[model samples]
Target chain A: MPTAIEQELRPVAPSKLSLRHVSKIFRGQSGETLAIDDISLDVSEGEFVCLAGPSGCGKSTILNLIAGLEELTSGEALLDGAPITGPGRDRMVMFQEAALFPWLDALGNVLFGLKLKPNLNNAERREVARFYLRLVGLEKQENANIHELSGGMRQRVALARSLAPNPRILLMDEPFSALDTLTRETLYRDLQSIFSKRRKTIVFVTHNIREAVCLGDRIVLLSSHPGRVREIFTVNLPRPRDINDAAVATFAHQITETLTQYLETPATKEAVL
Target chain B: MKRNLLTLLTFAAVLAALEVAGRNGAWDTRVLPLPSEVAAYIADAFTDGARRDQLPAAVTANATAATLGTATSTTAASLWTAFAGSTLTEALLVTLKRLVSGYLIGFLAGIPLGLLTARFNFFRETFGLVALGMQGLPSVCWVPLALIWFRPTENAILFVVVMGTVWSLMLATEHGVRTVPPLYVRAARTMGSRGLHLWWRVLLPAALPAVIGGMKQSWAFAWRSLMAAEIYVTILTGCGLGWLLHNGREVLRMDQVMGVMLIIVIVGLTADRILFAPAENRIRARWGLDKN
Candidate 1:
């Protein structure tokens, strides 16, 4: 109700981010392949949107486009009403692979993200990097080598790195898919806590339906093979929704049923979880 | 601990068998000298006043003085007598200085060239083709050109050493940059890394493993080329291990030849273990590129 009141008050506010009729075609030796087609989306400031679908749904491709890693074949990607021509620290990306530089320790890896920040001296940068590491519950492990950290810990370090730049938007591409179930659940709770504290607009890509239900303010369901917007589901469930909560399951079931109407693939069957 | 013991035991067994063969006359001592005799020759290097002396090579009037105007036989004579009175250790120092200097130059020059070769088509078509083509030529083949251009001075030796190693360094660096994981690059790019920052922070580190591999091979080539240069173009008053080996051969002293060969093998292994192994291990461990 407060969010509704806030939205009503800011009725004329421009969208924080928008993808206007975006399309992408990849040309390989096999010839032209349409990656995604005519996908339009608008994400308000501080909103958590999840793009969910099966493999080859171009969920990652869309994230890549938003991150300015890939060029769109057609249409516009705008941020705060301005066209996004390239990548910047304002929209940082977290890949599935933590992608930490091996030569650096955990703190050093986070510091690397702050290399472009010209104002801060070396000491200030270390302090900032340390602060972010503390935020991710990795303060004790800052000196740990990249390979020494667990897979979950590695992602946590990556999350700290992406956050350290203080980006306006965070693009995460299945950042937790490779983690174990328990780790994913724990990260969900931690993420929700972090999301509440630092209200950055987030676009998360995932194949996990319940995960989408738990984390997203709105889930943007995508269809595969030249990905298109299938539907959008809003989760009005209360704050810090647990993945195993009965309400979360009901919402997940509801979304799966909607997906079943269009997709009979094995991916829809996977949507139940 | 156990593996090291096994290696030592195996080596001793080989040495023992060779010693027995020499006593039984399995092969002529002239062609294949006795292991014991070779050991004696090495010991002789320690005790012989002339062998142990680090004095400057005797520049007698009769000794062949090599200038560019002379023939190959005269050059061979100059090389043979270059370290006749000086200690083998002095020759060793000369070889090592050339090897270190050449490898260092190649490293400094090759990194940027390799990066350029990988990134730009301009370099790939021009320098890249040259590097690849040069790989086919043996390091010794460059000696003739090096001698003509630099006239058998220290510069000529250094030139041969650089030419021998630079091509491998170039190819390795290019290959290293080209094969860096796309994900790492993409990840860096998304973090607002571009241009020189990206190259220095991401691309260079990612390419390190491959570059290090190239370094190992180039080091071996450096030693090979230094020897070739020392043996062929020895107009310099100072000598290297190659010149020492040539000296032994010219005298037809098989024991001295075998003794110097033993020193070469020991030096080669030491370089690999002492200079390169720890670096390779550290990179592999830190980068998670190890087989574990």
Candidate 2:
């Protein structure tokens, strides 16, 4: 095993996102509701971490907090030792809905991400956009308008757009959940390949256990009703894991069993009640 | 293609029925002239000799006398200019110019005001009620105040037109900006867009469909207001399409009146069909906003 001093002397990975005892409380007419309980998570550089749980678990809330879309009610979310105050291009988010600008075609949508990189001229930007479009296997549909693309194609365009910025951290909020099972499986493979090649710190939020088991290096199970981390499982499965593979299903089943046990626990039971 | 042909046929049928009605004396000639007679009268107004002959005797005398005060007399040498200026086409050009200018001014002012109102709660609370109130108040209602303030000039007409369309434009802009899906804004923000850049890239484009819809409505209001302004303010000058209608009615030239009315209808339809509709369709097609 590599010694701690050897690791310290080694070239550090670029992105290491840390959420230190983060909590979120939303106050409305119904009164104060704890959306996220105190939860701490550390995602090392180039690691694929998935927040997996059922709905109302604040999995998306945590993702949003990490993305700097919403401020933490307590504690801090840090990127490379600095607390995240607001949204930045360094942390690009891919939403479940594909949230693409309808007015922009596929190439245009991808180019939109390059807008932040002011150093690139128009030609350079176009080249970069084309590169990402091809990476997402959407080179042919570059000129196709948002409405012209199917749901899977739209998501691919969105993925291209998010990746075009070449952010240090990619925060995905159930990106493949909206697609059909077949498309989702294909995207799972593509996403795994992209992850291996790109080597970026990614925080993916998904309720699907199989998805989390297949894609994530580590799965962070969040319990519902004032979401808190229930269990953390390190998937020892090999790279480019198939969602339908027995190993993936076994890990998924194990995570699900742990999640159900956590749900049956007194604290979560009372919260649900 | 079939729809357009059907529309043309229906229009021709209406014109034929009207011509037959007039020829059969279903109504007195004084009440309504034959469509062909109106068409001929409009054509004659454009023709050189017939236009020269149509000038009043006193105006003709003034042109020959070359009085110092007769600065704008219809002299024989400048006969076409005078005739053209008074004809439906010339009136149309003047009216369209005013309508476009006034509508543009309102549109420019309205978009910023709408953006401000939509973005800020304070502006929305204060100006929102005023915009709603202005929408209820007709453009014609502003004419009286405009006349007193601008003294029956082009300014007065412009004032009325602006008042007519500005509120609608502002309201449309406000609604458009406000209704931009939170998702798009949030998405833009995550992409490191902020301030004016965000507004230009995300907010403005997001609100375009609504803004265009507003502009179409604004054009209609501005066009109507211009007609009202010309008829009322240019009682003495008789400068535009509205003035032509007023002059025809005053002189009991029923053919000229009918001809001007037809021009007005044509202008209105052309603005909607030829200009606004195509623009709207293009945007809808690009954005996939419209259903097949």
Candidate 3:
């Protein structure tokens, strides 16, 4: 453990979140179920990686492990060479549900995490929160209550709240899944633009193969039932990659084929509904 | 416009019917006094000064006894002695003491217990059920027990009021805590809030509406229990609305009893309408928790 003085003195490093043979087993009243079996992957500094798998395939369990929101049962998760014992400011997770506090308006929700930060006065905190709100294209919606906003708008607020703290690694668990297709597409373009400008390490989880192909530099496919890394496919596509492009389609097909094969296996076939 | 007019018409019709019935002697006067008679009684009490002198003495004795009893019971002190002033002042002091002390005790114990029951399943299983069971028993039922434990003093009445209010509050808090959406907890955990901070920042705010609703119910129960206990219990400590009602009954003054009953209704309704309504509405609107 780094001493507080030493930690303060050390320059902030670009976070490289890594998992080594991580596994999670859930024991319910009925029986013991393995959620994730020995999965190892590395998300390099400023890289966009998507973990793509079918529903209930433990893709979210991987994100949870990386965020240190849940114990790994086995193996280790590290951020910038430091082993993650629990959740910290360095890795922020955004969920499918916006989860913005209903009591707080957009600005207040964004400012919630910023308030916990040290050395910043009230004025500075407000400025920082406003900056992020504007960054997410919600400057005018700052005072709007969470309920007043549409579903897509709520997700945007959640994104602003997560990004306000400027965490080294952004962990999103199917954040855009709840939005309509058109809204999801718009958010994807916006997110891509932000990622291009900010160059933050993002681990995005999604079941949408096209989304994985569009957003991620690399897509890691996980097999269902005791989820493990099935394949790691690198997309050599340009920025603002078109989902309708032949190349993107080919890649999606190849990845989907591999995922389908894994799903068809007798043990997993029954589990992937 | 039509709906408003219809509502006004309905109200007028009811009043007109009541006036007609009273004038025609369709109902027994003693059992259900005419609205005009009640109004006349009120006007006489406030203006004629016929009953004014007796009012002060009754109020003073009741106020002193109530203040001293509750204060002595809670603090193990003789704060009631401070009531040795003018009759009106003593009455005011006694009412203030009972209301504040009883409310504070109920709130302090109830809120924490509510939180505890909400947080821990074991606590909820044991204490939640216990609280629920106790809530079913009227606060007035505790008067005999309070008298036995605290003796024939004002402490007994205070004890009864606290018992009446606390369980409802605790149950409300527990319900609020339980009903907090899982998303909020997950979101708070992601933001590195756990244990105390999680409970304070996320759980508490989310559960506040239910808790406040419970508080309103608790106050209603406390008010009723305090009046009943004061009237029946052997603790001759103070003069409250209940004590006043009791005196009217003893002197066979049905008009005075009706007047005191009117006071209770007015005070209770005022507290709900003026204080609690706006607070609850604001919370409900903010959370988007209200159905209508």
Which candidate leads in DockQ?
A: 2
Worst 10-residue lDDT window for candidate 2 chain B reads B60-69
Q: What overall lDDT, based on C-alpha atoms, would model 2 receive against the true structure?
A: 0.84
**CA displacement after TM-score superposition, residue B132 of candidate 2 (Å):** 0.9
Q: In model 3, which runs have C-alpha deviations exceeding 4 angstroms?
A: A1-13, A266-273, B1-12, B46-97, B234-237, B290-292
Per-residue CA lDDT of candidate 3, range B10-101, in tens?
A: 98888678878978989776666666655544433333222233465443322222123333343312222322333333333565577667
- The 0-to-1 C-alpha lDDT of every candidate, in the order given, reads 0.83, 0.84, 0.79
Write the residue-wise lDDT of candidate 2 on B31-135 in tens digits.
688888787666544433333456762242112211222323446756555455435555677888898899989988889999999989998889877999998
Q: Fill in the DockQ of model 3.
A: 0.62
CAPRI quality band, candidate 1: medium
**Predicted candidate 1 versus true structure: per-residue lDDT over A1-273, tens digit per residue:** 454223222223223999999999999999999999999999999899999987777899999998998899999999998888888888989999898888889999898878788767777778878878998899999988899999999999999998887788989999999999999899999899987787789999998899999999999999888899999998999988999999999999898887777777665555332
* TM-score ranking, high to low: 2, 1, 3
Cα displacement (angstroms), candidate 3, residue A52, comes to 0.5
> For every candidate, what share of the true interface contacts is present?
0.70, 0.72, 0.57
lDDT of 1 by residue, B109-164 (tens): 87788999999999999999999998778888988888788887888888888888
- Score residue B99 of candidate 2 by CA lDDT: 89
